[model samples]
Target chain A: MSQKIEFENILRRIEEISENSKKIYGAPLIIDPKTGVATWYDQREIKIRFLISIEKIKRFFEALSRGKILATKCVNTGEIMFPPQINCPRDPKNQIEWVEIPNEGELVTWTIIKVKPYSFSHHDDYIVGIAKISNLNINILAWVKCKDPNKLRPGLRVRLNIVKREPENYLIYQLEPLEEC
Target chain B: MRRKVAIVGTGHSIYGVRNDVNLPELAYESIKEAVDEAKIGLDDIDLVVVGNVGGWSSEYLPAIVINEYADLAGKSTFRIEAACATGSAAIKTAVDAIASGEADIALVVGVEKMNESLTPVVVEFIGRSGNYFWEFQNFGLTFPGYYALYATYYMFNYGVKEEDLCLIAVKNHHYASMNPKAHFQRKITVDECMKSRYIAWPLKLYDSCPISDGSASIILASEEIATKITDTPIWIEAIGSASDTSNITRRKDFTGLYAARKAASEAYKKARLDPGEITRHLDLAEVHDCFTIAEIMAYEDLGFAKRGEGVKLIREGQTYIGGLIPVNLSGGLKAKGHPIAATGVGMAVEIARQLWNKIERGRQAPIKNGRGLAHNVGGTGHYAYVTIYSLTKPRG
Candidate 1:
């Protein structure tokens, strides 16, 4: 079972005990066996999901489907913005241009997320990494796919690729390690 | 001329999983203590500033709730959020009020109830604290994951072994063992820390601070009121605050936090202390050690050590008491338990107690300079605050 399911099971057990405690004590109270402290389990539950607006930068998503990653290059300052933004803070004119990110870069840092967040607990352990695009001086954060994590280190050559993430079945960019020169 | 501000009284609750008390109760524990210690009636307080990051807790409006419960309702109050440095931000806000002649007496309280939610949910909330849409949405970077990136690069660049980072955990726990209010009171060995499994790559479970529910409160008064309240008021000498871009990708490099370095420089300049000889000017420091790697980086950012030399300081045990400068003697977030908002205020409480020589034995720093510094960083250096507290009044 996924970690999410395991967590749900524990929550379910707590709810069951809370129900029984309410029937006897007239409150959703459960006493800790170790500390003997009474705690009232909250009955109200809330699940939050944000509907973020990506209207101005929809082209970045459109390019992802076509197997190309895009970043916004400021027309005034020639500065590049990954996770593209239309308005350049440096340029008052809000002038911007879309450019394909250089696929080849060197890995600057990486980490494996073993203790996953609640929303990401369903997925297996994933490696996240940052890569510095050659000559651009801008870094990109993305999932890193590799045969082994031990082989990963700083300065390892990595190439960005657009691929469909599983389960979610959405297009996203990732990094693939390339053999050392 | 700016009026001088001083911390006349301070209070801190035990840091750990406090499922026994609700949010307001936990906050009141410190509030009552502070009010009593300051010997001021609730009506004497002109303002109350609360520092809390509360998405994980049930209380949506903590300031009002805490005020109502503490019998200080109807006082001018507001809440401040600067991630983990919320407490320092709140303290600074009160200090500014008193300095500007806005209020003679102000109460600064920092509290967090992170244990109200499940561990996974709390993880999700903190993970999304940064540039949520850009970094966490697709990347799924947990708090530890963000710091692990820094750990990986710093270790590789500086030839720092995982064992060196474990030594930090070992030292913090050693001091925490002496602190009854700390979370992990049992001392841990380097071998045990090394054996701990990795929560995020290069950062084992022992490297991270535990989720804690606690509160810390301090009473700040203008020079006129401070003298009437207490004879040994801890003077707020300087407070320096700064922020960085939300996106980590925008940073030039991750070796050290630029924001922290900037804040520390401003504080040192204001306090008239030479950064080169910072240890000689301060008796101790309470740096944000949310992660082992963070403490090492803080040493560099705070000018305690040169770049790429923080690891050497830890390796040489220079941060321990009787060394160059004692750091995080109150166990630190690593072992003291990090209660999001309360940590910064807790640092102030620890410093005040240390300066008074009232802290537990074996952990107290020999207070020669009668000055202390608190380096509190919020969200991987997204927000930074450096505050200096001294026994004597600050000179104009």
Candidate 2:
């Protein structure tokens, strides 16, 4: 199943219109018949795909494969770092250790992504939540598995779990409400 | 000792899905106005700093294209980006150049052509602004979704209703209707705003600023040159900026922006003004209302209201003219339109004109203190800038 009208459909429509206009005008120039405003339709397109360097904190990804979430803790300052860093900000000389983040945390905030980005258009509306890991003093942002967001509120207890995201089938974390489970 | 800087001229183009003009033509629209207003030719400009975040637009080298188009090819020019706060960053660079005696007069132009690509593509590019690897690559947070999280937390913690947020949209549109250059020229009711479709849960489509294409420019000069340029010059009082963690999850709180709070305090301290009583020192403010919740957060962050009391200010209409303190009198980013890079410079231009009482009749704030404020934030408060402008020269 697909969206009733995918965004790609709209792009196709513009391309069709541009092709027809190009035949008559000898260019991909479009004149908004309604407003009489002239516009040149760009013929070229660039698809961006980034290959980010994740070599330094490879342990974080390795821990994801082991069904565990990891964060960094500076041994010198006793401070926890999320999105686990390779070096400590306070003092790079300080030794850091990888620690498993707590599965259960309190939901601090949440929202349902009604209008998604172009890349995320295939997916249905999703709920994203942020939770605070009290012990480590760090928060994690993830998709909250819920349909009734009306029932969700701040301070609601949520537990994080590593699972294979469907379609892509990649290891990712999600937040699940305590009551629902 | 640093030389004082002043804005001798300012310019702004009409904000909307501008299919009428391309990047250089649009940039020149403001540049021409700014140059004409300063009573100086392009040859007088020693430096040109352009603010443009281009992924959706066709131009890769916007500064180079603009310099050649505007006939400033010989001038020192470069592009700057601080997410949506690129315009302020451009001004900061120009001001630094003038203050350092490197340039006597500088022209800072901020322009964005967001409508070059389709809306969906534009949405995707903007959504990827903050922490791309952890946030967007995995979770996929749109610009509205990022702010909606804060709105959810604020609503849950402070007992704020969705109607309270709609009030912000209603007020901004009301001012926008009065502003000739605003994207939305029609006033909207709170009921109308509430009935609008939700772009992100807790944030309606009306609650968010439009994808705008526009340009704004300002000519900055040192005290000696500023005196000769114009009779009425808006002095650059103070510019305070700060940044936060790219990852939203790393933030300790979500109710208000921490970086904005830090920037406001820094700006007030530098101006020798009390941060707590910001409303008393400035006649008006043009806050980064990228979304409705953002305006409310700005209130608390700018010390217009205490924590959790931002909703009350909106409900009481304190931000409107004749209220406790007027904010967004020029419709703000919410309705004036957010052309990303152009927004901060547009705010500066609007505030400068407002301070001189040269703007349109209906939307001008009463200039009681001869001062104004522009609060521009980028990427979910990851980058924050608070710029203070004054009619009178500041004493050391």
Candidate 3:
């Protein structure tokens, strides 16, 4: 179960008990069974969802749908930028060109997140890693589908592949070890 | 290029899960002590710079709230945020004010009450501090996950063992046992650290600094006012600040923080101290040990050890007091607790106290050459501040 839902359920149960007590005793207060302290449960609830704009780099997502990994390269300096960029920082006046990243790279490092943040509570423990793609002149971050982190080693060859994320049909990038397990 | 400034008075609140005090109450605890130590009241303060990263906490406008609570509502105040280095950023802002002659006396207060929210919520907020959309939104990288990348690379490339990292926790906790204000006052053995469960692979729970609640404050006075206010004013010898790419992948190396090394070089040049011989110049240092790997990297970045040799220093017990240049004598962020925004200011307070020779025995680094260093890093090397504090005034 998602941690958000688990915590929400606990909050809902408290709300239901408060409503039942108010209906029976004409008070919106509850006494703690453990501490014997009177408490007034808050009724207000707030929900937040941000609106982020990706209009500048929409091509990156469009290419992702077509199973292509794209990176932006500076027209003048020939510097490649990952997480695709709209502007070339080195030469402001120069235009940036979208370039396809080479599928193969070397694995730098990785970590398996055991304790996830609340926003990421829905997912099981996942491994995140950095892979250096020589063609792009940059490192890419992606989920590493590995059975054990101990098997992973620095300088091991890896490749990027597009796959459908489980339980959420969304397409995302992943790293696969090119060398033998 | 401008006039000099010094820390005349400093105050630090106990670092722990401080649920007993609210935001302003916690802030005032340090403010009152700093004011008393400076022998100045609200009227003498010219400007206030507050450092608070407040997403997990209830208060939004902490500067205004603290101003009104401290009875300095009419004074000019501004809040600074640079992730965990908010405290040092706040000090930089106030120092700029004094150097520019805009304010003769400035109050720099850094406060955070992270315990108000649950652990998961705090983790979520900190996790989003990096390139949120690119790194966290899709991948969901926790703070430990980010540092774990360094740990894995450092261990794999440099041949540092997990036991080597555990030694850092053991050393910091040993000092924390003597610190009355530390959160985890009990020391742990290497066996205990190694046995702890993993938060991120290769990085155990003992390897991470806890989500803490605390406050630290420092009163900065211009060169003229500083000499009259206190007999033992710790001069702000030099400050070197630098930043790195927000996305962890953009960095060139994983073994050490590039920003921290750059800032240390800048600070060393300004202080007229050679980076290679930093350990010989200072009596003690308080480097940001947000993680054990970070402390190891700090030794190299601050030039206490050569690259890949930092682990050897810890393994040899060189970082302990009475060893070559004691470090984290106030227990550091590892055991003293890393209260986010308050951590950098806490480092400044601890170093100032060390120079003043006012800290408790057993933990105090014997003062010689009248110098100290504080290396505070924000985020995963997103921002780095290397500040040198000295008893002798800066010639420049």
Candidate 4:
């Protein structure tokens, strides 16, 4: 069962047990199905989400929408950063500038995520991979659009493609394997 | 002036689902055993260090809650987290305290209640351990998926087959069968491991460690106090720790953990042992076999074998007891159970038991060198800690 449905079923059972337990025991008591161990079900349910600030590197997101992937480069040290950073730690006076990542690369490693997290369980199995961009020291991690993962191998040539990820529609870059190496 | 520290007592709880007890109650089980074994009371311990990486678990301040339940209230207590290596970090913290004369007697407890939450929720929490925004948030990489990335690259580079990885699971399960406290007590065949469903490509269900709920504890004291407490005190010869970038993409290589190599080298230098022939100097090892690929990588990173030759070691059955080096005699995290933060302390307890010949007969190593090693890694090699335990006191 999907985690969402499984969780709902559990909550429903807990609610039913609480209704009976509250009348007799005056608490949310439960017994585990597998172990038959008694437990006190927590009444409060909390949901959490993070509000991360990307104000310093907002240009990277803006560039993503415009069909360009951007990385930060230290102007003084000539250092390139993917998943870009605004500051260069090598020197105090160094300024960071946005640079575009190359469209071509070779697959360094990949894994088909058969067992996904609770949040991603809604979707089918996906292949997550890391590819080293052409002529660049930096590597990028993204979902690889491949029909057969068995055909995927390290050193296989791939090209970057920016597309909208559905259900949670947003622009993200992915890798598409080239026909010829 | 640095002082010598020794583990005077060790305790391990039955590792499995453990739905019978709450967090503190589970922790108290090991704490009581360790205290009794040390012949000490709660009042005897000067400091307490708890290791727990809590996201799926309910307790936020686990150290205080656990201490309060164990009747250790008002004690100098704190919790340390280094992802899965939290247990080793706790032991290291307590060792530092005793070594620095900050406390003469200290208690270290590593516990995790991973089953408190649903498996999917726990999976989500561990998957977010890496560079969350870059790797997990976009790709939704599970913990097994992260290790599978390494398995893919390593197998491609070294020509290791899936059967070679299955051998590791098979070997660990064989040893876990003899360990009463281990989560998996039944021995498994290579055919069984191969038939298991894959959690990630190249990593099957048997390759991965179970999300376990358990606790392990150790009591450390200065040399003067340790000699008085127990005659078979396991000396803390050396503990070396290092870290790597949180982003997996930035790693120099995926074949093996660089941090583990650095930590192992540092540990060898501290212990004054040769890395080239490290297996000869130690009786056995308890590596962080959270995944089978991890154990293979550990062999190379810890200098047990040359680069890309780790696969050969497993194929030749060189890691089993009566071979070059017996590894994961307590079944490792693969079969013993990985209770997150509790795993490192559990490793220490296993090594200590092995060194003292206190463990069950079939899985015990013949302690010829009077030494054993524990290699614990956290979060896809984001953190690494290598600890050496010896029956002999260090001259340094």
lDDT of 3 by residue, B163-254 (tens): 99999999999999998888899999999999999888889999999999999999999989999998888999999999999999999999
Question: What tens digits encode model 1's per-residue C-alpha lDDT throughout A54-161?
Answer: 999899888888888899999999998887888888788979999998899999999999999999999998999999997777899999998589899889999999
Residue B190 Cα positional deviation in candidate 1, in Å, after optimal superposition? 0.2
State model 2's lDDT.
Answer: 0.91
Please, what is the TM-score per model?
Answer: 0.99, 0.98, 0.95, 0.97
Model 2 reproduced share of reference interface contacts:
0.91
CAPRI quality band, candidate 4: high
Q: Which ten residues in a row have the lowest lDDT in candidate 4 chain A?
A: A2-11
lDDT tens digits, residues B168-263, model 2?
Answer: 988999899999888889888888888999998989998999999999999999999999878888999999999998998878788899999999
For every model shown, the clashing-pair count is 0, 0, 0, 0
Query: If you superpose only chain B onto the true chain B, what TM-score does each candidate give?
Result: 0.99, 0.99, 0.99, 0.99
Q: Is candidate 1 or candidate 3 better by lDDT?
A: 1
Task: Give the DockQ (C-alpha) for candidate 1.
Answer: 0.88
lDDT scores of the candidates, listed in order = 0.93, 0.91, 0.90, 0.92
Candidates in order: C-alpha RMSD to true structure: 1.2, 1.3, 2.6, 1.6
Candidate 3: where are CA atoms >4 Å away? A1-43, A179-181
Q: Residue B8 of candidate 1: its Cα lDDT?
A: 87
Model 1 deviation from native, Cα RMSD in Å: 1.2
Error of 3 at A159 (Å): 2.0
Model 1: CAPRI class: high
